[model samples]
Target: MNKKLIIGMILGAILGIFCILGARLRLPDHASFSYLLSFWYNRVILGVIIGLLPSLKSLKLSLLRGLLVGVFVSFAFYSATGFLDLMGFFAGFVYGVIIEFVLFKLNQMEKL
Candidate 1:
């Protein structure tokens, strides 16, 4: 993998784990590992955002591209949020699609 992708993955994982640990400490008795996993897993939006960093130059849009980005993001999130592995995967995938669509619209507007 390229340096940017590797870095993004590492950063994403670190952020995910940090968030989980922070949440656990703050919530204490209320925090369940499963719930924390689900919460962080849903944060795929963060990954989608990370994926868009490189595309800011070209701003191209494609489902495949989105999925690839989502996969990497999911990987990072999963690696960080070790509580639930695949939980973040699905959430991240859907979140990536949504964010990509939003970014596409925004980019189109910027052209006008």
Candidate 2:
């Protein structure tokens, strides 16, 4: 597996864990086990997408790529829930940038 893929997957899973907790805490009544699982998996997919997407020369462009992919991937679940989980949805955007930032840093380090 590519290092970026591994990194993204690991990061995604880590972020997913947090998402599960946040969902549980925020929507205690509505957050079912299956729902949480789906949420986690969705984040993992986001990581996969982030890992697979081509990197750009500009840091800003790369981060924007992450943001767009994050929003696109996250929108599926967001709409599925009828847009009830705003935090979860928005978290996707943040997580996307985080994943990209980590990968970008790694790339920079590699060039040194």
Candidate 3:
């Protein structure tokens, strides 16, 4: 198993949990899905994306993969609740781009 992927997943989940907790602290009476936003959106999905960073060897690949996942997830959400999940799409897109950049830069630094 890929250690980096495992660690990334663990860290992402933890981060998402913290985000949910913080939001709850601020708004105890938050909406239903609001609580799961961080976990489902940022942690699980984002973790899976980041964990696949190795095979997503290029920025283009990352963007393509991300866009596909984003659109699919958004579609699922929309179909389930008849609500267009703009935030989910946007967040997934941004996560894909950002992770690509981070990984690219890390590779560059390693080569230097």
Provide the overall lDDT of each model, using Cα atoms, as 2-decimal numbers. Answer: 0.54, 0.89, 0.53
Residue-level lDDT of model 3, residues 1-112, one tens digit each, is: 5654564455456555654565455556643575467335555556555666564456677667655654554455445544534454455555444544554455556521
TM-score, cand. 1:
0.47
Q: Candidate 2, residues 1-112: lDDT per residue as tens digits?
A: 8888888888899999999999999999999989999999999999988887766678998898889888999999999988999999999999999999888888788731
Which candidate wins on lDDT? Answer: 2
- Cα error, residue 34 of model 3, in Å, equals 7.9
User: Which candidate comes out best when scored by TM-score?
Assistant: 2
Q: Count the backbone clashes (under 3 Å) in each candidate.
A: 0, 0, 0
**Candidate 2 TM-score versus the reference:** 0.94
Ranking by lDDT: 2, 1, 3
> Could you give the C-alpha RMSD of every candidate to the true structure, in order shown?
8.0, 1.5, 4.7
lDDT string for model 1 (14-55, tens) is 456655776676567755878676556545346435544644
